[model samples]
Target: MPPPNALQLLQSIFGYEQFRGRQADIVSHVANGGDALVLMPTGGGKSLCYQIPALMRDGCAVVVSPLIALMQDQVEGLHQLGIDAAFLNSTQTLDETRDVERRFMSGSLKLLYVAPERLLTPRFMGLMESGPVSLFAIDEAHCVSQWGHDFRPEYIGLSVLHERFPTVPRIALTATADALTRAEIVKRLALENAAEFVSSFDRPNIRYRIVEKDNARKQLLDFIEREHDGDVGIVYCLSRKRVEDTAQFLCDNGITALPYHAGLSSDVRARNQTRFLREDGIVMVATIAFGMGIDKPDVRFVAHIDLPKSLEGYYQETGRAGRDGLPSNAWLAYGLNDVMQLKEMIENGQAPEAQKQVERQKLSAMLGLAETVACRRQTILAYFGETSAPCGNCDNCLSPPKTWDATEAARKALSCVFRTGQRFGAGHIIDVLLGKRTDKVEMHLHDQVSTFGIGKDMPEAAWRSVLRQLLAGGYLQTEPEFGGLQLTDLARPLLRGELSVQLRGLPEKKRERAERGQKRSAASLDIAPADDALWQALRSKRRALADAQAVPAYLIFSDATLKAMLDAKPATLAEMAHISGVGAQKLERYGLEFLDVLHAS
Candidate 1:
């Protein structure tokens, strides 16, 4: 037969029926000696774009990955497909490195994954000079941009690839990047001439929800108990201390939770990550330090006890869940504290004024997202410059938020901030607005002010909501020095009687939203009870097989595939081959075993 083409290799080795979205075009471009910059979402099969091209091209593809764990995972996955793959990282012994180096130089390996740090080493560059490189695949290419959430200085040195291997095709790929970050990646990586492939940023399988923070831990527990029990998920915290405490609390509540952060020993973090990937139903409680380039595909949900720093970070983190295309959740509990803390970080950090301004803008966008009552999906997509209609599955669309004419309330709050010399934060401003004769108010002698008691009619929460909306709506701004509120120029129009503000009211009662969430979560996550036993049996078999092979279970077959097996009731090898993930190699390896299980069922 003619040398196997990209499509032939894709079906024979990877087992997917067809390319998704721009995969084919991307694979063809790179295989034909063209450079590319691919911006696809997580779980969008970015690996196939390069892997297929590598097999179709002349030599081993040098995949510059960031994480050692990710490199090992990808190598193992390719090995499972019976493809020649290996990774060279710190985790490898000198002998192991030598072996992979030998394989690469001999052209026996189709793909070689190396960390960016390692790839930049003179030693590794010398190795690359010794052989023909089919292409250079830079995964998480957004990390090259300082503006990206996960910036790495090592990624900046990657431009050397273009300088040295000028003739070799190059592909830079990232799951998350806004317009600014995209341009930065192109400039930084010297990919000005690469073909650009931007896929849809939407992840419709995820049900997005943002709730106001109130007893956030209790609310998180309720969500866990109701919807995500016995399922793998991630609970993101804003601080290392919170990660530790939350993981302990979950464990105390009889949930399997692990803490991951930069503070932990590398050994502990690695063990936890290995367990999370290899086992099912592990809830990883971590700060922003975790969940980059993770390959697990069955994570049922991603919950945030604290607000994420940016929309890009939020999207990338939550994209970790429901990678198998099953219904999953992107849930968050945000409040004014999250806003204040994030703003304080941005302002107080040592970054230059322009970078800080960009960060503040990003955070402001995130706050608007938190406070938005419209479709959460629409807001996120719009931030990415993609327009989308309301997705009825989100919290806002499912249970619409209440709104009130807060124009007068907003004016009162703004007047309070101004009359207080704009030096007071929301709490004192609320106290002043509510006419509370506290020591601070009395000390400041603010009871004599014109706007002091003008807003006593509204409840304290409602007043806080109004102030929050004022801040979120740009009618008010925060002074980072004292965490106080000030009026922005946008407030000028409102103060001048040229504008009116209408704010979203509180969501439905906690009990009501929780009840509705319970129904929705059940419908989203649960399989048919009649097939539950078979599903469990198949999972157990997968787990057993994974343990024997010492690989993650999902690499054997995702939960979605097992669930499909339960539903399809495939009875023979040929029938098993018809499943979505069962490529020829996989079917030849595990098809008979799964068919036997189905027959037993």
Candidate 2:
């Protein structure tokens, strides 16, 4: 077996003649006998850091991935590229694993993707020792840091790759990493001499927007109607219940939506994800659990109904959109409570003080991003030690937010907290502000407080903005366990009239990109081509087939099928296979019928 030229491999496998950003340079560095640490954003083509070198170098390259399914998907995708790539993990049966090892021994395998746990096993290690190794690749290398979102114990053991194959150049890659996580990857991987390539973290394709979460579902509906316009997107919720409820709500509102989380059965998760990839205009309402290796490139938007734990997590989740190098959106719906709830959870956890402090700093940076009045892209880039000017595309840039004097409002809110004993949440406190005769306020005599009815001039939403800004700006803290608003030492200065506060008003949630005269790309959100006839036909066919099989419509031809039919204008059964959703069994069952109806209409 002979190795392919790097340029040919890149063109044949990835469908690109030239590399993006630092990809070619990173590839050359690894091919020229150098170890590398690549900090590329999601969709930055980090896979090619070692993939190209693996094809050009002699022997095999092993990619140590954190997720088993991610490993499997990479291998399968490589196979799609007509390359010899295999994975070894718990998914493989004893016989299958042995057969893969046989291929490895024969030098027929150019690339092997393995879960860290499986790769470190005695049997796997012994087999690897018998074969010649060219390079070692680590994916999600941030997991080596305890502070990362998806930390795995097995990642720490990956250092053994250096001890076992000391001569092999290793490349570590991650989509999200701060100074702390970056240091951890270098130290844990023992890549003291690795060439570090930190690409620009700014995702210029994604327009970032944050809206306050009052009547969250309504806000989400308005956002979806304006931005979505029948496109594929992901909605990230904090809870499984929210995931299910939001998915159902979207479906009820005439959306082809589905839910994904750890709560669903593995079979159901795989089926839903498969549908998302194949279908156009499919909306996946999922917890953080769903998206890791989902390769869908045309996601028009990534919306979050709750605050993410960290900026890295937020960036990775939002990066899921616009991977195809097209303009997309990152819409976030959250409030002061979302910020506090997350901070409270971590503050109460029994982790190491240093680790908790580091995570808190990361969360704080994310909070700053949410509250930033400058370009959203600049805020995200600054977090990664990258310099960026205002992108002039985000909600802030389009509207040019104006700040207001929040000193009086801040003082009143702080005074209300002090008078109410700091036991109540934001709602009850808001109730007190409007002089509402709510029983809870009367029961606590909160109506008697001077601060009550003092905020009558400002709208409740404005007061909420002030409170959120105060908390975000570190003037207050929420008890990590109790999660009640509490005045911080910093609040004392404002409350005592010693300091005035300033705040940027919340953006009008009702106003979308189009409403503000900020035109979206002509091809808004890699979307399903407009052909209602084909869509209705494919859907009808799917429903009828699903009824006959007594399975979900997704189990039949996915939403992807109709979109593909509309896109490719498939005229025959042979062309149906070109659509991702119509598998062999499905093609045999419904292919002819689809083409006949498509042609007749």
Candidate 3:
């Protein structure tokens, strides 16, 4: 018999009837021995672009990944599909690694995952030479770019795959990259001639919301209680202490939360991560160190209490939510302190001056996204060089923010900065603006300046908003030494009456209440009231099975797959085979168990 084609293999092995967006084209290209550089969004079926091709081709495909947990998860999922896959990482002992190597040499495995660090070792290179390697897949390909959010020094050496095996088809894939990073990836990966497939960077299912931080912890609690109670989510904090504190705060408030960070013991981190993946409704509050290769599909929300340093980092982190294409939220609460803290970190870092400039630019872009009054989706897409219509799903579109002509206020703010000799920070400047006779004002003698008490008309919050926008708009900059606010050349125009400013007004209380009313929790969005019991039953069975196997519940079947079963109500094993995620292997393993639940219901 002839080998199965891409579409046939997709259905029989992966159980998806059709390819999404550009998967078919990519699969055919790579299967025919063409190099490809694919830029796709998270949860956009990027795996199938190479997985199907690996099965279609002649020999084992070598996958270079950065994270060991990611490799283990993917290999486990593949094993459930009856595919011969394995990984060689530090977690494996000598015997286990040798077993995988033996399988690779014998051509019994279809795909072998190894970290970039190990893939470049001389021994591993000789092992590759002894086998009929079909292709090379570099996952998280953006790490090759120095400017990328997750820069892995080892990824830069992956270009040797092309140099050594010029005839082998190589594919590089990443979920987030701007034009500059894309160019750098091409240059660093030696994929100049590879076929580039860039998908739309829009995740319409995620409703973006950014609010000015007012009691950030309280705001986070309110958000969870109001829209996402009993849901699985990820909360990101910039510091390990904050991660621990926030997780405890949520737990104290009756939420099931766990803390994960680099500071935790390796055993503790691994245990927390395993619980997060295997259990339901677990909120993992972590630092950036925790989320690179998490494959959970039912994450309903991603919250950020502290501001991310760059828009790329923010996008990649938020993309973790709604992997099943369900309604989710990317909620952020940021304030002036976040901005100052991030700025100070960047300035005080040991990076070179040129790199520091790039960091500053990226931070400015992130601030723009947070402070913009336009559709958040549109702004994000535009940053990625893709034009999109207003999605009408983000906070700005749902309740357009009020903007006021702060031209006079901006000039006054700038004058205060200049009059203070550009030696004071926002707090002192604000104190001077409000005419507060604080000790700092008395020490600085700022109470004698002409602009000291001229801004008492506006509230302190409004004045802070103006300064933040000015910093975001390039009218003001922070000094690297003292983090003091200083007027920029752009401020000359505003100070000279050549430019006008319109700052976002404070969020209205009525609008906030209305937005809350409009948003339905993840529980109420897709499942009907009548099917809630059945849905819970199906999920419970999945959880029990996953627990038995010591794998993530989604590995057994994704939430999307479970929902499909709920909708189809398949009553027999044969009918269960027709479900989207139920391939032949899964039908044999899990079909009857699920059918029993459906029949009982």
Candidate 4:
């Protein structure tokens, strides 16, 4: 009998009937010993491009990954398909590693996931030389780019795969990479000759929402209680202490939450991550250190309490939500303080001037995205070099933000910064602008300055809005030493009355938005009230099976798969096999159990 083709294997093993986008072409090219560099968005089926090829090719395909948790998760999910997949990481004992090595040497393993650090080791290289290797898959290929947000030093050494295994066809894949990062990945990985596939970076399932920070923690709580109360989500904070405090706050407010950050013990981090993956309705509060390679499919939201460092980081993080292509949210509460803190962090860091310049540019782009009154999705896609029509899914598109002509207010704000010797922060500048006679004002004698108290008509909040827009629009910058507001060269035109400014107005009361959010909550799941009971029953079955197998619930079957089952209402094992995710292996393992539930319901 002939070897199974990609489509056959995809159906029989993975249970998907069709390849998405360029997956089929990529798989065919890689299977035929051609190199490929694939840039697909997260949840875009990038895995099948290499995974199906791995099965069709001659020997075990070696996948180089950065995170051990990612390797473990993928390997476990592959095992559910009855594929002989294993990972070698620090978490394994010597004997366990030896066993996996033996399996690889015997050509019994279809895919072997190894960290770049381990894969580059002399011992592992020797083992690879002794075995018949199929292909090389460098996942998260953008990490090789020094300019990328999630740079891994070890990934820089991955070019050795091409140098050493000259004949082995290799594939590099990433979910997020702009043109510069893409070029860097090609250069660093020696993949210049590889066939490149660039997919659209739009995630239509995610509703992008950015709110001005006002009692941010309370706003976050309100968002959760109103729109996502029993949902699994990830909340990102900029500080470890904030992660801990936010997790505790959520728990105190009756949400199931956990904290994950570098400060946590290894065991604690692992346990929390495991819980997050295996259980439902877990809100993981974490810093940027927490979520690089998480593969959970049912995360309904990704909330950021503070601004991310760059637009690339924001895109990658927000892409984590709605992985199953369901309606989800990418919500952020941004404020002027976030801008100051991030600016100070960049300027005060030990990085080279060139790198700091790049960081500044990236931060400015992120701020523009946050402060944009146009379609948020369009702005994001444009940043990645893709033109998109205004997606009516973002908050700005759904409910347009109000803007005001702030040219005069901006000039006043800039004048205050200048009059204060450009050495005062936003607070002192605002104080001086509001004509407040506090001790600092008396001590500095700013009350005597020409610009001090020049305009008490504008509220303090409005002054904050003007200053923030000034900074975001390159009219002002912060000093590295003391975070004092200073004028950038771009401020010249605006300060000289040569340029006008229109700033986003303070958001009105959120009651109407809250009502829309409630509607969105209902739409996110979209199961009819009559089908809700059966949906819960199917989820319970999946949970039970996952707990028994000690793997994530999604590994058993994704929420998408369960929803398919609920819709199809398959009656028998044979009928259950017809469901989208019910591959041959899963049919044999779980078809009858799910069929039983469906029949009972």
User: All candidates' TM-scores?
Assistant: 0.97, 0.85, 0.98, 0.98
Clashes of 1: 0
lDDT of 1: 0.88
Question: What residue runs in model 1 are displaced by over 4 Å at the alpha carbon?
Answer: 514-523
How many clashing residue pairs, candidate 3? 0
RMSD of 3: 1.3
Best-to-worst lDDT order: 3, 4, 1, 2
Better of 2 and 4 by lDDT: 4
Kindly report which residue stretches of model 4 are placed more than 4 angstroms away from their true locations once superposed: 510-519
Worst 10 residues of 1 by lDDT: 517-526
Predicted candidate 4 versus true structure: per-residue lDDT over 1-601, tens digit per residue: 6557999999889898898899999999999999999999988988889999899988899998888877888999999999999999998999999999999999999999999999999999999999979999999898998899999999999989889999999999999998889999999999989999998899999989998888888889988888888999999999999999999999999999999999999899989998998899999999988878788999999999999999999999999998998888999998889999999999999999999998999999999999999999999999999999999778888778889988888888898899889998999999998899999998999999988897798988888888888899888999989899999998878889998988898877784466465546543778989999999999999999999988899999988899999988987887777788789999999998988899898
- Whole-model lDDT values for every prediction: 0.88, 0.79, 0.91, 0.90
TM-score of 2: 0.85
How many residue pairs clash per model?
0, 3, 0, 0
Q: List the residue pairs that clash in candidate 1.
A: none
